[model samples]
Target: MALEDVPRLGCGRSIDEVWAGIDQPPTGHEEHCQYCQTARTRLQRLQEATVALRESDLHDPELKPRPGLTRAIMDVARAEVRRGNRLLVRTTDHGTIEISEQALDSLIRIAATAIPGIHSRRCRIDIRTLPNSPHETTSTARAPRLVINFRVAAAAGIDIPKTVDALRQKIRTAIPAGIGIDAGTINITVEDLYDV
Candidate 1:
């Protein structure tokens, strides 16, 4: 067989089948095929390394979660949220500031979740502005018009329409001024009615 073909025999067989004899009873194929011989030698070395690792792990002391691990993870996540690209909320004659998409979504979730009897699952945000709609000639784009979709479940025994209306009002108050959203634009899907 060519030098390249030695590796092809192990392709279809599992490593367990090829290395069955190592640290165990001998298999008969080791004497016949040069490919199997070469593969067997390499597999023996890997098996030795793995056994050493397992023995070391067994001898080591038990590992426990670090103190304040949850707080450290949350701090990292908050920093990542702040570092995201902030959308252009609007531009003024003096200067401008921005907010990240992640932060915006978080606020929307907070607004929807705050309503009594409502449990919000997910939310999506969309922004669009017409091309050549006179904002092009302007220095900055228009305050981006947005559409928000909310998925939620209402608690049993609560009036559905009232709950939805309350949600709409809360969201309206939650959103900043000059942003174009309304009861019509706030799409709420009632997924289920849950007790307690």
Candidate 2:
């Protein structure tokens, strides 16, 4: 079953809601609800494992993560943060300029937030270089392309379709010229719903 459709307890509480209230004394539903019981068992095991892991990390130097692991992880993270999202913009006065993916993400976030009922949570911009098919032996000109994906948490009781269309319009207008993506390809997903 989907998470939203999971059977709640008699008190209309889900496993997650109860999990959040972990510090509180257990209620009748928590004891009787099969979902809650199962969740509690899993959580208890996880808690034990976490304690064990931390203790081992403190006491056993051999069990610790390898040296340079932090540097390696940071390197990969920096590479990901720097790569594939730069937008080549056509500038009239100053020739050509490249806008970083981070800038594009910020632009998307701003545009999305301008829509009354939607707030952007995250924005990702992907710029790809077109590759030639295997059948074509001769090399083709590398044409750059762009795709935008954004997730939003929207207020309840709004028309989602209309919201998406308006969001698309806003992004199209805000994007600087020369990012080769058509408006139709810019994707928007309302990944969450919240009460305001």
Considering summed lDDT, which 10 consecutive residues are worst modelled in model 1? 176-185
lDDT tens string, model 2, 1-196? 6777975655577766776766666678777777777777776778778989888889997877999999999999988887755665433344556778787777677777789889888777776656556554332233446677888888899998998899888888776443444433587889999898
Off by over 4 Å in 1: 1-64, 94-96, 132-141, 177-184
lDDT of 2 at 34: 77
> What overall lDDT, based on C-alpha atoms, would model 1 receive against the true structure?
0.70
Q: In order, what lDDT does every prediction score?
A: 0.70, 0.73
lDDT (tens digit, per residue) of candidate 1 on 1-83:
77544344643444556766676644666667676777788988898889998888787665436778999999999887777
